[model samples]
Target: MSHPHPELSSPPPLGKGALRVVALGGLGEIGRNMTVFEYGGRLLIVDCGVLFPEEEQPGVDLILPDFDHIRDRLDDIEAIVLTHGHEDHIGGVPFLLRERPDIPLVGSKLTLALITAKLGEHRIKPETVLVEEGQRQDFGPFDLEFFSVNHSIPDALAVGIRTPGGSVLHTGDFKMDQLPLDGRLTDLAGFSRFGDEGVDLLLSDSTNAEQPGFVVSERDLNEDIEKVFRTADKRIVVACFASHVHRVQQVIDAASQHGRKIAFVGRSMVRNMNIARDLGYLSIPGDTIIDVKQLDKMRPNEAVLICTGSQGEPMSALSRMASRDHQIRIEEGDTILLASSLIPGNENSVNRVINGLTRWGANIVHKGNALVHVSGHASAGELLYILNMVRPRNFMPVHGEWRHMRAHAELAKKTGVSDDRIVIAEDGVVVDVYKNRAKIVGAVQAGYVYVDGSSVGDVTDAALKDRRILGEEGFISVVLAVDSNTGKILGEPEIHTRGAGLKPDAFDDVIDKLQDALDKAASDGVNDPHQLRQLVRRNAGRWVNETYRRRPMIIPVLVEV
Candidate 1:
């Protein structure tokens, strides 16, 4: 309400005075993410992401990184290179453009497809220079190459960056999936080529670095999904991230094999389906995808509902269906398959949606109950595999919480990487690189920006506190009385309440009690709105608590009579 604080919460930018890569966010926590590698008067940002706070942040919408430290150096930001399509990796682009609108954005085809789709929602046309596997581009003196890597999403990759001082490889969120659902694998041979080409710095994802073994391949999930469809008795409802087109393709195959017609729901699901099908990345059988309005025409056993909201995004189609708001109401004996795992901070929302669906008599299947989800992050073995392939002089772990970063650094040490090469960073800590060597020079002013409704750079900590107070304490109203010629209030006060009062007629009665009190407070020969307003508020607050057994926020309005 008070013009939300400018999102750049920190003071200023401070670097290591050389080639420093600063973490704006996403080092310790999961979002408001960015990594800046600065050298030769040019800046290259790997990602800018947003991380949603836990359930405790009531009514506080999405939170983004404060770009203040880097905003002043916007001219040095040559490009923002991306690694994948996940929300945590790309969701903050619109927010980033809000601060520095001119940075050149680059990503693979599918990554750009998803981002452009998101930008379309705001009527904002994005300008992204598409990069593909085996292609390299230069940003001033920084050279970049996209090395394809397999993940839950299609076209995931690790970036190979060549700066003047040396070459740095940023292994974006990835895993080794030789037999991928999308038929692409991390090009270890390509990484080997980078090492052969003299790699100097390495940044890898730490998400699953603590997991002991290798990540499961998506190919392994196909058989399990096939069994679910072949065994399901009634309608099949598939819940997943809309951007996971490869998974969607697999589900479509399962549904088609079972002779079911797939009807996609959720904004993201529909949009991505449109993009993937048009781009030839997904293949659905003829007449397989039908209009939701025609759902009744299909037989119950042949109905497949592919919906979004796997994580209980309130507006997603599956969440609405849980509330019985969707056109295709879930019925008894329907098989609801949650094809995505619960993200760290979204367990509550996801479980709530599952509970709501179960209450409607649908049997829900998730992890442990079925083969539904597999993480795209690398496990210990896979992490080792990547480190061995890219053999760099320095290493940094990214893409996880504080624990993940620590675990990953430990893993690197265990895999023959020395402690000095592993640089553990947090949000705003800049690492300076020069002549193929790197070290943490100092810190940068990096923090988060909050986006609520149409307000960007709003919802600072102060705004969040205000929202929390409004949510918890509600609001109070006070009435004051003044003599016709003087400002004064009565001894007793009136109580007006919304959240604290149980009485239905409380506010109506409050007006009368307030007028009575005001008449008493009136000055003999003076009447003033400001003075009366203050008196009304103070008395109303005290009176409400005493008479109604509760207190609410006090707002006083005074009118001269």
Candidate 2:
């Protein structure tokens, strides 16, 4: 008889193997927001996300969770439920499905539409189950009800997965925006119903866990933005996230109110806007929004440009315009409204854009104690309110930093949630909920997988370390000859070095100093290639550090004679 590995079975089988929440990443950062609900051997994932690596991690583009622990159980992974169309929540789906095909994905109509489009970009399309708000679906052993939640992006929702353990509310990025620009609010009624229905375990967004009070309403932005638009007599280039349909709607309304035609620039902004408008999610009056190519015939005073790169993304139209390289130029009196906040890790890029706008005689505005961008996550009061609404026996805070999760957990304690009820987890940490309590159940192989261009999971720690070393020091290449039998260098050593030239003018002269050092030093009795390589590397590092104030990566090439 063939049997599965005993270790792979359910963890100790406690309390009917009751409701369990697994945080693969979202617990400790703003990006890569994902949470897993497991009950009765059925697994449903919410928001497969990816984080952008910090500056310390060079050459790495995006960081995704390593799913090897659950790779073998793909069948149990019934569906991937999305919260919104934001990159952090939906970016990793394409990479996640690369290994597991034929997986049913569940999200809102527009969310699924955006996800389908993203998959199409990869030339790999799968069946994405389009579940609207208030839609219910049942997998093998669990029942889930998804409802709309207002956020910066349209069609965002909170999920209620009902299992035998209890109903677990996975509040994806949301806020209590009563007067949302999109005219939809986070369903306090449905949430109240869940509260009335009795929730056993609650998993909520802790991204804003540290924030004290309720987040400022999204409605406040319209007043300031309307003011900006009303006063602007010249062409206005507004930058924001493409998925932020609510913000886009507000921009459209502002443009309409100002009697200015709208034109979308940048690929993603244009594509998402067209998709939303075609799907009737966004309504722009006839020729109210023109394409950039069509802008040639329109007067600049009558144009309101809505484009991507509010974060100052390099390829975005805003960046191109800032550089004065785009087909559309912002002459004097031009106004550039950076309607998005500087997402952490993108300060340099966005700051560069701001500098460029300033240099090019354009007025720029962004998040600086201003009402341009409002966060979507719930603050402390809203967090407490959700906790109180659900009245869950156990609370697991996901989607924030250690400080954030801890802050929320502490607050949960103050809100009548017992000490055992609050379980703060890190990335890959698992918490089991049974009979009104939550506790850790060890960790799984849940870490990040870096995506660098054509390579997936190629940006390894070792690679990143090597890059860091190269950046910190410089790079030294040692080419030496050794006898094959004796393991000794038979000739003079050739030392080639490049002061890790992150730029052309960074460390050009350090190579000359390294060459001088090698020319002066004599070969040692250590004929072994390995030993000689080590010696050369160590010496080169010391020399570069002392002389050029840089330590480059040292590469020793030993050729045997």
Candidate 1 lDDT for residue 250: 87
Quantify all predictions' global Cα lDDT against the true fold: 0.77, 0.78
Off by over 4 Å in 2: 1-15, 482-491, 500-526, 546-549
- The total of clashing pairs for model 2 equals 9
| Each prediction's TM-score versus the true structure | 0.87, 0.90
TM-score of 1: 0.87
* Model 1 lDDT tens row, 209-268: 779898787778888889888888889999988878878888988887778888887667
**RMSD in Å for candidate 2, one decimal?**
4.8
lDDT value, residue 35 of candidate 1: 82
State the lDDT at 101 in candidate 2.
70
| Residue 76, candidate 1: alpha-carbon lDDT | 85
